[model samples]
Target: MGYSPSVHKFAEGADVPVPLDLELVRAVLEPHDVGDPRLCFDPDGDLQFWIRAGDGSEAEIFAGDTGILVERPHSGGVFGIVAELVSRLGAVAVDPSEGRIVCSTEEYAHLPVSMRKDAVVIEMTGERLEAALLGRRPA
Candidate 1:
């Protein structure tokens, strides 16, 4: 099967709370030995982490108030990593092609019923990063 990249979108509301525990996140990544993950802030002030995979490819996970943005090269193991995160962190997978939430965890059982309209949109781009560092949105 070909690899399909998807973003794990955390739903907002009283029922589906976003996981903000960075230590838990680090713990989940420990088994993979992702090294000492570096934390950074995005343009919108969301927390992000840079993790080095076993194969040395860099994978980025941006933790927003309501969701997480994962950016990885077309490497083979990203899907598994995402799955692991879903299993450990209770994330909902949003299929990139369909632009909808496809799966839910036990903690987010209400997700499937929530529909696509509720899925949070998270965009991570180099221009956004540059603008954030410069303290201005790119024109």
Candidate 2:
């Protein structure tokens, strides 16, 4: 099934906090005519689709397989847990913001020289990643 009409309507040239819907991602990239049908993982171990269009262009889109991975920025302890989880899942942690988990097959390819305080920039697309930073721990 495709994304709800409301979801498409909401996504129309807008950025919002919506769980990664597999169907919607497929529909959104089909028009692009990218590559062959393939599945990949994001930074969070969530499933994603890789479409190989006619022109051989490739598009990577998130599939909402995994539910809300991390609501807020993860702390050292929590972050370690996530890391371990990904490792066990046979994936790697990409970004905490999007909760991008990817397989070893998918290399980082590139990464920013440094992530800014409270800001993450996707090295590939050069887009700023926004996610709530891990909150302070109580004394």
Candidate 3:
């Protein structure tokens, strides 16, 4: 994981092609290192994914492994902002050549977007998003 943007893909709730600012994503994620395997679980069990990173590591995100997942303790605006960013990023990174891409819930909807796909909510809240990616499992 030598910070190759072209080596990544994004998939959201749509089938259309979308361009992403890899630099932006990198800026958001570059501060952390790849570590743990995070999980997202939707009520309907329709969507799932994880992010792996660690201290001083680049974050790697993945989706579509669980049901319609939603993280808790989030308000409408925050959720929307995060969903927008994640879905936008996902849409860009998802490879149509491999399979289908879905957004599931629209931005601002009740969709869950983990700060880091690999770590637990505690780790995310504790500012350990980067540590989790470095293969550090949450206690």
Best by TM-score, which number? 1
The sequence of per-residue lDDT tens digits that candidate 2 reaches over residues 1-139 is 2210011111122333224455544444445423344434556665544433343433333435433233332122333333333333332234443433232222222212131232222211101111212222222
Residue by residue across 20-113, what tens digits does model 1's lDDT show? 5556655655565443434355567765666655555556676656566665433435445555665565555554444545343343444545
TM-score of 1: 0.53
How far off is residue 75 in model 1, in Å? Answer: 3.2
Q: Quick one: ranking by TM-score, best first? A: 1, 3, 2
lDDT head-to-head 1 vs 2, winner: 1
Weakest lDDT window of 10 consecutive positions for candidate 2? 3-12
Give the TM-score of each candidate.
0.53, 0.24, 0.26
Winning candidate number (lDDT): 1
What's the residue-level lDDT of 72 in candidate 3?
28
Quote the positional error of residue 61 for candidate 1 in Å: 1.4
lDDT of each: 0.50, 0.31, 0.29
Question: Which 10 successive residues of model 1 have the least lDDT summed?
Answer: 121-130
